[model samples]
Target: MSQQSSKPEAPKSGGWIKPAVEYGPIVLFFISYKIWGLMPATAVLVAASVAATIVGYLRAGRLPWAPIITTAIVVVFGLLTLIFHDDTFIKMKPTVVYTLFAATLWGGLLLKKPLMERLMGTSLKMDHAGWRKLEARFALFCAGMAVLNEVVWRTQTENFWVNFKFGSIFLTFLFMATQLPMIKRHMLPDPAESESKGAAGE
Candidate 1:
């Protein structure tokens, strides 16, 4: 008789695709900015942002609030860049977005709710305390990033700010990766469920 082979199932394409779709526009904007300059790049970015939002809605059958809001802001600021012939508006976009996000996160913590938990409600499992702590940390990090963006953009040029945005995003990704172990450790397991399962087995 031939033995049956068993293999672990691969993760769904849907799981990884959202991040790629989200970042693709940013990458395109960076490249276009390098080759074509801010105005043309902002135009491409505005288009990409619109395309991303459409794709998000089509794929999920509903609009994601974050991307929808981001797209609107980008379009408005991008138009300002083109209409006024100044890049300052575009440069300030990240600062505004980050500051708003930071405020939301921190404010949620003050209200005894973690905004991140609401945002990632379907994806992860965590108790109220864990979520609150995570929210506090995220709020601090976002606030720090907003301050850093302000400092860099005010002291540096457009190219430098663009580079900083791209580089800092990668750095933040790495920082999150490093925190996964801590997150896993702090996660609360269902003690009653585990005990029932053990009793059933015994």
Candidate 2:
């Protein structure tokens, strides 16, 4: 009789708290900017963003490109806001972030890869076809977000934009949750073990 060995299971996914650590600064920035207004709050918000960026990099054991770039931009714009006494710099932050995200996603599509796959590479497993479909959906969502951001900021008050930014995070969570069903349905099972189980049963 031969003994069979079982393979190790994959690690469990990290909880939402992990992502909250990354986005918490943006939430704080929106809150502070609205409650205190840009003049008095911009410095504090920028500092928080910088701190969050550092914490994120430390937690991940490497610097993430998006948060690092965003932190740098926030610091530069925050300084400009202070020096010029103009809120326009701070106001443009969302536009810049969304535009960059949109461009990256669309560019990935052009290059025959999805930017989301690259970002989530270590976190999930899916086949090429699954990746392609997921990537296309994510790219479209990013583009839609970019347009929606522009529309809200242009048509609404500063406070409205601030609220919208905070609220939009919920939508992102929902979108991610919706993909789980598709992922489960398309995920490949362990074929060799399954065949062995069938033989044993027979």
The number of the candidate with the highest TM-score is 1
Using all chains and alpha carbons, the TM-scores for the candidates as numbered come to 0.84, 0.78
Cα error, residue 72 of model 2, in Å, equals: 2.5
Candidate 2 lDDT over 84-140, as tens digits, reads 998778777767776777787778878988776787665566776677777777766
How many pairs of residues collide in each model? 0, 0
Clashing pairs in 2: none
User: CA shift at 73, candidate 1, in angstroms?
Assistant: 1.4
Local distance difference test scores for all models: 0.77, 0.72
Q: What TM-score, to 2 decimals, does candidate 1 have?
A: 0.84
Model 2 misplacement above 4 A: 1-21, 190-202
Best by lDDT: 1
Error of 1 at 197 (Å): 5.5
